[model samples]
Target chain A: MSCRPHWISPRWMISALSLCLLVLAVTALMLGPAALSVRQVCQACCHAVRGQAEYDPVTRIVLTTRLPRILLAMTVGAGLAMSGLAAQTLLRNSLASPYVIGVSNGAAVGAVAAMFLVGKWIPFGAVPVLSAASGLMVTATVFLFAQRGRNFGHSLLLTGIAISAFCSALTAGALYLAGERLQTLVFWLMGGLWQATWSDVLIMLPLMSICLIGMLLLAPAMNVALAGQRSARDLGVNVRRLQSLLLFFLAVTTAVAVSRTGVIGFVGLIVPHLLRLTIGADHRGLVPASALGGALLLLTADTIARTAAAPVEIPVGILTALVGAPTFLWMLQYRAGGRAGV
Target chain B: MILRAEGVRFGYHIDQPVLRGITLELCPGRVTALLGPNGCGKSTLLRCLNTSLRPQGGRILLDDRDVMAMAPREIARHIAVVPQDTPTDVPFTVRQMIMLGRYAHWDTWGQEIADDRCVIQRCLERMDITSLAGRLFSELSGGERQRVILARALAQQGTVLLLDEPTSHLDIAHQLEFYRMVRELATEGQAVLMVCHDIFVAPMFVDVAILMVDGNLLSCGSADKVLSEQNIAAAYGVRAQISRTGEASFQAQFK
Candidate 1:
């Protein structure tokens, strides 16, 4: 596990990513439309803690707007990436991101359907709950398919595509019935922290911590899992329990992230995939590294999304996809064929 | 640990069982080869014995306790397995690869305890793979990879070892060396049940042979007695002349 030099090892990767996260958070807090100097950022923090006054607009913006947005981005990003790593391990598929495996699509289906058609009858919480249910269904379907082991190629991806397509169609049908709400659904599906608030951070933090802890606990088994499923089981992993628990957590975490921030694509895939290559593949380290890597990646993407073209903000999802979609293409050609560890 | 399968039955489909009520016991210090032609269900039977597959009919017992009812860790403490193929692309150095065998023995946090490291070292050295410890498992040649996988299984320190044709893909020299290692382990008081189709080569190294045909146990006894030419023809549908080359050793020439 300590194969790499200390500088490049998984522990180092986690350290590097954590350092990057701190720097990026501060920078993100400073670089918005109303530029806040370091002094202003400091004042904003102090003012936030002291609850002294709604001082100048600069501190006000930093404290009220950028802080919550950045926090949400990191938490959701960490959540998705951890879930993504867990899903990849559980499914034993390199391409198994929440988006690729239809978990995100399932969440979208639940959110859109609930928002449009069932809103009157259901409580406000139905969207997230329904999204998790649908996500679980999609995940369970793929899990069963994989267990039957038509694995090691595009078959699993194809199944995901089919289920995701069905989910998307259902969403579209719901939107068709409620045509006026189409804009909102489209915006949510595009995914952003555009409306980020303190409440969103509060909602996402506990889930992120849970994902991190769950992933860390599952990390060692996940390391053995890299040996492949049958080997893992024979090596004393309860493969059934490991796979199902991973899928359950993956679906829940991904569904919650999607519900909170809509559907931010590729954090899960790119973060874990990149971390494994750069640091190493031992999950004990990969789990924490991916969490930090996801936070760093998404926060950076978000910073650029806000500042790249000032007043007209780009959705963070757009920024992530700008890199993610190409990475997915590269993986489709490379890691899919390089499906040795899966 | 003595592993015994009694009246074990399994099938992907109910009407066509892959292991049909087969009963067998593996004794300590014996290297047993489960032999048959392709699709004769030796591999399936091994899977059932390990509780990776639950037999449809009877029970797999480890020291008389039902394997299916025990936890995987509980079963693995006594039974380790080497499958026919491991994912070669597993991105770990040989040391890390072998460290995974300690998964069943770890506490919740799973830090490698001092005792675990000692076992890993012994397994690595015993497999003659100490020199390859720093190399990635995926970078090894086929024979080296098999040796690494064997060392990993040995790290489990189980009394019973199950393998499924672990050397079928290796060259003849490597195949012989692999079985020699298995024989050595068996001599050290481990009960080994290996599923292999090297009918010609297997009989030379194994202590006993369990011949199977279409999911039924055809014969089980000393290799010389069970792998008789007639039984070979019956189990594998092949004509062969099995000659006892030496005391308790054999060579098979296919017709």
Candidate 2:
């Protein structure tokens, strides 16, 4: 075993990573087309003194546009991270994620269908509500399939995969039907924070906060549930009730994330697994750590998406895939080499 | 905590009953070993008692209270169970695993109260595994895992415990150790019901023995009365010689 010390304790690592993320988020807000110095940003934020006295147009842009985008990144990151942690522990599989269970695809299908059918009638904020409803409907369908027998993980995963495939086919059909007016919609599917507004932040903040708090409250029960269904029952846990509550929470959180930032694959899958290696599957630590680490990673990715090509701002989703795929490959190699030592 | 099952009839389908009109009572503060051949419904009966597998027709009374009417968690508060062959895929520390036994005592949030920790400590102490508390259950040997599981039951602080084939994988020393722990728990005023196939050791382990053949109660009484040569032969369909090992100890050999 490698004798690497100091980074082993999860609390220290989480705190260090969270502090670094706060700094990175501030840097993201400060850097844009019209660059504002850190001091200038602080002064502009403070300059909301009586009757809008001499406010910079760049400062207004920072407050309205970039701030909401940063908050969107944080909320989606935290929500996806916590959802991934819950799915992995509940299924007792290292590779389990909200997307692996088809939640993202389900939300995407709902959004695409709603765009095709009801986009003219509904506003932008209403699209997320429709997408969330669709995702939850799919989750309910999968949950019913899971309860028919004793094989919990096997049944749940199989049902999730089946639902994912069905949703993906629907999404593809919608994309094909939307031939000419599909440019912005297709870009949305790839996922970006280009249109993030105060209303979006207003909605996502409370939803993600509630999910995070609820998941933390249920952390102890989730720990018991992770010991497998029968063992959990023998220990006096109501295994069936636990499963229902978890599925509901996971579906809602994942739906919220997908609604905010189209189908951002692999964030949920990778963040929780990396945290598990250090924290050892105790949800008490894993939940909070994954949330922070996820926020940091996406904030950094969004920053690079903005600054990497100054003249042409890249879609944040494309940047995430570009960065995440290589990191995922390296993680796979590390796991194969036994460097993780799990 | 006496367990009484009256006129129990269970079947997967109505056409073929697994347990047919079986009536039995488990005495308080005693270890009762359940003996039966394969496919004879020993595990089914145990499950019925624990309310894991509800009998299609019967009234199971724990301390004369109808088990069917009580909530499962309410029943869990009074009865702890160790199923045969619990699958372990995830690695958990013995402390973390045993802490789950306090679930009935916790609120919806599953808080570990000071009393819960105290009960867990005493359980680990009783099982002589305080040192192994930090060890991962998957990392432990089979014998160690069994003892930790029993400690989890002990932590429930229930009046009755139902175990299914608890010592099947244990060597002779660990087998005796397991039985000794069960006997000690019974002496602490908890009723213990264990299903075991070691007919030879069953006589020495429990105060009473219940013999089952083809889902019917063949015999139920004191160990000496129920472990008779005729009863053994009748239940197993084999000839046997009953020999005395000590002044009060007896063993049966197949002929």
Candidate 3:
């Protein structure tokens, strides 16, 4: 029920986040490694549809490569961030992340097995879809294992940690044995936008869309879940089923992003935490805002990585880790100080 | 109006029973204070009433319909609860906080109907929290937050309101204010069941008191009849001095 003036409620925060996301998206599309003016970008985008011979190669690059990259960055970042947000809420731990708590690690193991282990049975890239499928499988396994009893937190986090350790060890062993292909494998682990193309974006779009809509549908449930399991169940939430469903959705989103981005850490960890400071902990606000914030952060980081040294590109993941870790530390300090005062 | 529990038994595991064979009917339009020391099945029994905790051996009925047979949302439509230490980790505005009570009635997409909005506004007004509506829930003082939670339960507009120790920690003024609000709700024919620790305050405020001991309902009747020295000592293991404060009113003090 509406208890206050409509003007003073959460609608304003939602609209505010929406406006920020739009501005960030436009900025991302207009500015990048190739550098296109807004007018030029628009004209190029407009004329390219009809096979016009008017726009330059730079324009084509923006239309065909960078725009899709930006969309993928936003959607994937959003998915990962929302997953992280849901995980944090579900586990009741501010430090929880799809990656840090092992969901991404599990996915990585799955993907790596698909690449290295599955390759023993098939030709190289013969099962091109193996890594993604494997990632989903691992994520599902981790989710199921984490949701057995009342100790959802310990079960999920501990299982994730174990899975991550196992995956990391296997990945290390695979890298050690690969020899000549180690460079390519290392780059995949470091994470970059070098592989981003229209096809990759097409592959990711449907899954990302489904995950985003699913998170939005569960926004209220996430809100209730934040009140803790007992209270949430009392409030008519089927806590066990809702938790499992959330875990499945989170893992799928995490696995997809990991399969593409190779475990970009802070998009999941930092983005949602940052949004929580301004928007509070309402998942309805946090999920969408985290998506927008993650996309904007990653795209901007990627754009800077490409242009900072102009010919030698820095990996996008490293740049975010550089920025994100300190911000996370500051939040920890702020919260600690707040608690001290109390 | 009729709250019935027939042969109720519960346990986390099958072999161990936390509650065994509890049969009682809670009468309507009265304030029933459930009293016992910790882990005496006070919370367990309350949870069963709303199907938050499933009954292992028996059934709970609300208006002749089995409680477990009804959907959780349907039960929520009739029974609103204020749980212990409801945390506000997020800074939802007071209005947003109270509107969560309307969640059961909300659509799948969480759309707020006009009637829902009206009920929220009325509850906020009733709780005298109209001024606090714009404040972040996390920013409120503990007493203020408690009132907002009470307002949220009121917004559910349930005839049976269940509160677990609604005023466990409060200043004297705030504690008295909470019961005053509870009395008002009861006057409107809502069945108010509250778990209380302050033996003196509950009997003073409630019409009926349910004293429980070792997961058993030891006595249930009007506060004056049920909260005698013998019953209070049996349930709480405390020596008490009972004094008549007014006609049909008594206060208890420790020796």
The per-model lDDT (C-alpha) reads 0.83, 0.79, 0.76
Candidate 2: list runs displaced more than 4 Å: A1-14, A47-55, A118-126, A176-178, A181-186, A318-322, A325-342
**Native A-B contacts reproduced, model 1:** 0.67
Per-model TM-score of chain A alone? Answer: 0.85, 0.91, 0.87
lDDT over C-alpha atoms for residue B52 of model 1 = 87
Query: In candidate 1, what are the lDDT values of residues A212-310, reduced to their tens digit?
Result: 887788888989988987899899998777766777778778877887778888888878876776566788888888888888889988989889998
Ranking by DockQ: 1, 3, 2
Best candidate (score: DockQ):
1
Best by lDDT: 1
Each prediction's TM-score against the native? Answer: 0.91, 0.90, 0.88
TM-score winner between 2 and 3, please give it. 2
**Each prediction's DockQ against the real complex:** 0.60, 0.36, 0.37
**Candidate 1 docking: what grade?**
medium
N/CA/C clash count, model 3: 0
Cα lDDT of model 1 by residue, B1-255, tens digit: 799999999998878878878999999999999988899898889989988887889988888888899998878888999999998878788899999999999988888889998998899899998988887788788999999988988998889999999997899999989999999999999999999887777778888889899989889988888889899888777899866767866777899
